[model samples]
Target chain A: MTPGHLRRDAALQTVLWIAVVVVANHLASAIPIRIDATGDQRFTLSQAAHDAVAHLERTLVVTAYFTADLDAPYHEHEAALRDTLDALAVAGAGRIDVQFVDPSTAERAEAAQRAGITPVTYTVRAWDRQEARSVFMGVHVGYGDRQMAVPALLSIPKMEVELVRAIRILTVDPEDRRKVALLQGHGEPNPADYPAQHPLYQLRARLGERYEVVQTVGDAPFDEDIAAVLTLAPTSPMPAATLWHLDQFLMGGGALGFFVASAQPDYQRGTTFEVRHGIGGFLGSYGLALGREVVLDRVHNEKITLPAPGGRSVQVDSPLALTTTHVERTAHAVRSLRSATFPFAAPVVVADPLPEGIQAEVWIRSGPESTARPGPIPLDPRLLVEPAASEVAGPHVLAAVATGTFPSFFQGQPPPGVRADEPLAKGRLGRLLVVGSGDAAANNVDFVLNSVEWLLEDPSLATIRARATGDGPMTPPPAETAWRWKIAVVAPQLLLGLALAWRVRRRRLA
Target chain B: MRNVRAILRRELIGSFGQPIALVALAVFLGAVALFTLWFDDVFVGGVASMRRPFAWMSVCLAVFAPAVTMRAVADERRTGTLHVLATMPVTSFQIIVAKWLAAVILVAIALGLTLTWPLALAWFGDLDPGPVLAGYLGLFLAGSAMAAVGVAASSSTESQVSAFLLAVVATGLPWLVGYALPLVPRPWLGVVNYLTFEYHFANLAVGVLDSRSIVFFASVTALGLRFATHALEQRRLA
Candidate 1:
């Protein structure tokens, strides 16, 4: 070939290559084909998530409210949420329309407020100064006239599961939804409050999505249609009549999700007080008891920011705030959960052998490297120190479930206010889920939600909602196994190097 | 195609025949394994993924790729072998492709050696092959782009040392630009990030097969090969 022909041919090949690449890129972006090789298939949408969005007969609109220009971790959460929404949009086949709304604007903020999406305040270091910025990271799903909102996307691991559950709630017929009675009037946070800082507001909103949640005060008769009753951190002792009512309700095969706190901490006062809500005798009779001591695990826990001597806040791991990834011994309700943190938790003990026809299972437990201290403990930062040798080690249960017929606490004699006409000899089949810490609901709402769904005998919702993305857990290998892994990682390269060296030596000799 | 294969076979043999090339390969593989095992602590992290090793592989290729490709064209010109090759019936494109393929194959072999990472992780814990496979794919593509840059650098220079330095700078420029991206204006940040090799490779490292990223690497390889071809033509004319 001539020089000019060679130049032209080379130029043509370059142009053709560029064109092919540009076209291929555009096509690939247009049609994304992903293979989720994760054990949980985290990247791929679960069948339940697909079915929830695919079966959308009416238009479902998902409005994501995320503040722009957030810090590192929050931005990652927003990106994951966006990716999940994109996946949902693909699975929805155009039935689901998603709009990302920046709630920094007044109009959008008001719209978010109307949809019950709240903004969380974060302390971010900006311009070399600590600044408190309120950022909105929430999602609202609307189907027809009904709507449901995830108040905060705090946990990215459960983001997809939350979106799927929200969509399922919005699509289902309201009347067919299960009913849960929230026992109130005991100084628990009101479920009707919508403030972002309110602890139980998000939990109530989430439960309201799938259940007709009714807040009933003392002496209020248990509704016949109610599938379960949720009593979260009841401060005051219930009246004898209400206690009898709860007993009768349990006798009638109703489920109970009790989130009782053994001690309540006063952060302002730097102190704690032992709480007696007067349900201990009832629980003990049912072969379950909440310890007066607080359980602390050094191995698996969360850190808290404490004011240092230098006037700057330093993060220190606290035994009071425990984070546990040990879910192996849990029931199906919490079996799929990767991790959960229980702040200010007490120990749940199986006090005695379960009665005949009764089955009890411990759902969550503290790690083996844990200690429990008698409560009314100080809430000072100094108390966050490492566990001493004197502290006890244990596998303390933090939450448990008991299911079966039971002889009531008032089996022999009725309470002072109870009527003799009430049946107490033989209780019907029932389930009682007892969680030792109310603060756990604040950290892991999934645990509370899963417990409720399990109590309602709806495993599908519990299992589907508990499914998370990524590998479930990677327990660190033993020391010997780690050494073996190191050997395995390094041996191949060494072998190759030796082989190359030998080949070179052989060639030189030849 | 036959001519290209023949040239490729000859290049492979020539590359393996050199003790320096073998030593470079050994050093590259050993460094990757050491960095992944000790510095990144894949075993301690218990991640059961090759992300750490692949990440290190990217940085390693920035150096090793240049070493391998510097001698591909520059040493041939230094030894007066290029003029002889030019007298052959095969075109310059075939010769360039053969050299490029040989470098890519070397990189693939290096990457294949790191498979023991995931295999070892699997022995101890559950290792996800999906992300590991994706990570290897990203590494291969990234290494090919680096190889193309090195070849282009080699074609532009007759001194092996100058070619190695130039290729290293070329491959390192994208990473430097990526690190400086946060300082860029917000409006142009997306475009700047898209131009970065790390940005594209990272998406694939996480098991995402984004077409835009693939396109970026492909474009880089093609541009480098085109530059090398032009350099050869200019030398021939001179």
Candidate 2:
């Protein structure tokens, strides 16, 4: 039959016409479909959108505040932002309305100001000129008390995750006090003092999604409802009262996470090798010390500086080494990052003398090619030597959790001058998570959120990796026999199997 | 229309009914599983940096696609079936569309078996499903372009072996193009990379489906099929 004769057939024409209509309809649905390798896309925003259309309540207005500098080449950023806003609309499904307002122009700024929204200032340096990028993500979700608010979303990739978190916040009653305590005193990194851009600050705020985060320090009686205590990298010597409060909390069955710097190499003050937290009497009794020197490992090095620009680098010991438990949650091990340079650091160590029942599980560790400078520490790194000379070994633990019962530094009965409100018998039992480095918890420290989540005991708030990670600019398989796996054996085996199949297919056909 | 239907039905049935093709489909499914889920344990922890899970899966699929589609036309010529096919009352467009549809069906079937990966991930975590959907869209779009390249390569050679090799080389051009791009002239190289299947797919993989990526894939596939048609015309002249 001719092509025209085939088209004249009703059934064939129907199928063809239907195919066009179906493909066009699906294409025109304007439903941006994303099917990932792992079937995570089963939960379509289209469903949520439909739901919103059915049970629509308050209208969600999203105002995007951005730089108005049209001449600048940051339009790439603006384009991405526009795409993200479009995604929010889809997710909102007729409930979320979005508007973009560029603040570079005087009129736009004046309008935004009148709306009680400030254009957050951020300076991003171009090759020549340094222009500003506005930090206004979603300044307002609602207007009145019933209004849902999204403080800001900095990047597009993380917006969906942020949107999910916002949904939980908006949905969940804000007054619910899911307890969280910020541990103070021991030379820990204070999130409140951290810069606004710091992860810890952002993390703490994110935790407020399901938690009532309260700062606890000094002689205040640690509350019972406190689910976890965040012992951020503590720098100053911890006071006895402070140690007592921590021990008591743990004894009361509360959880604690410490993002401590190990005997890190960096020197904040003086020429001391030790990272001193006043908890020596308290934590020392349990057999963990924030070691006075950095822990170095050889296993997980990406690259270290080769003394060149971009430097001939290898990933030996990174100060920002991520000691994640990827394998299995409980018994997960860490990499030996030997060349991940800390510049200088003081790491925590388990003391030689230890009481039984106390366990120290290393969260993250340093690589094999590490050394230690014990006392009268030098600021310059040239002084570091081989292990035989400097006294250190492979796989030094960077972060760890120490837990067991304890004799409070007070061995004898209660002190004579006891206040009426104070309880008798200073002795107590509880678990203590002591980290070595104080800087690890700081904003300037490792922004790897898993560490904080591990520390905070809030797995939901675990830090998502930076957006630039997928580029994998430096990572490569180890050429060394030690790091090289049985791929040599496997590759050949695969080749042999394919060859066998091909030979069999040829023989059968022949 | 009758010719296209005949070709499409024959191609789809012929491709799907073969035990070797079924086994290949299963193997591809196995690969999607390994790449999406088990690849982490394959490389020693921290060695691969396992940067983005979806990116690797797509790259691996890009390498694997031609192996499935390389025989659509090449083997027919090798077996002298093209002479019989050419004498039949069908145009090259019908043959092309039929073979292309067959390849798409084969890939779609393979993709169906791999849905278990996402199902398992959803059962495990509270991940946003859009990116995963976007990822599948990117994969299908990428795989379609690869299928077209396979057709082009297969038509150019009488030997299936040579066709397979050519298809591999052609399919791999996008990777080298994407990798070596930024090192060359910035804006020009950027455009070249943007035209590559991966450039848009990666954007889509993250759940932001820009129209440019869809258009790029469609155009590239058309170009590849057009090249195959030209190669067939050249063969006719010979």
Candidate 1 chain A, run of 10 with poorest lDDT? A466-475
Best by TM-score: 1
What is the DockQ score, from 0 to 1, of model 2? 0.13
Candidate 2: tens digits of C-alpha lDDT, residues A1-510: 654454345345445644654454346335544333322232233233233333336666667665543222232355555665576566556777777776667787675665556655555543344556564434444422454445455554455445544544554456754677877656555666767787677767666655778887746557756667777666677666666566556555555666555343333442345556655446556676655555433233222222323535333343223232221123211221211233334455777656665666655444444444456554323333233356666455555666565544444232334233554333334445554445444432333334434444444322222222221112222335422233332343345446646765675688
DockQ of each: 0.35, 0.13
Docking class of 1: acceptable
Per-residue C-alpha lDDT of model 1 across residues B1-238, encoded as one tens digit per residue: 8988998898888888777678778888878877877777776543445666777889898888888899888988999999988888877767787888889999888888877877776765556677777778888889999999999999999999999999999998887776555445544555566677888887777676666777778888988887787777666655
Alpha-carbon shift of residue A164 in model 1 (angstroms) = 4.8
**Residue A96, candidate 2: how far off, in angstroms?**
7.4
lDDT of 1 by residue, A340-397 (tens): 7887788888866787767888887776667888756666647647665555677788
Compare the candidates by lDDT and give the number of the best one. Answer: 1
Q: Give the RMSD in angstroms, all C-alphas superposed, for model 2.
A: 9.4
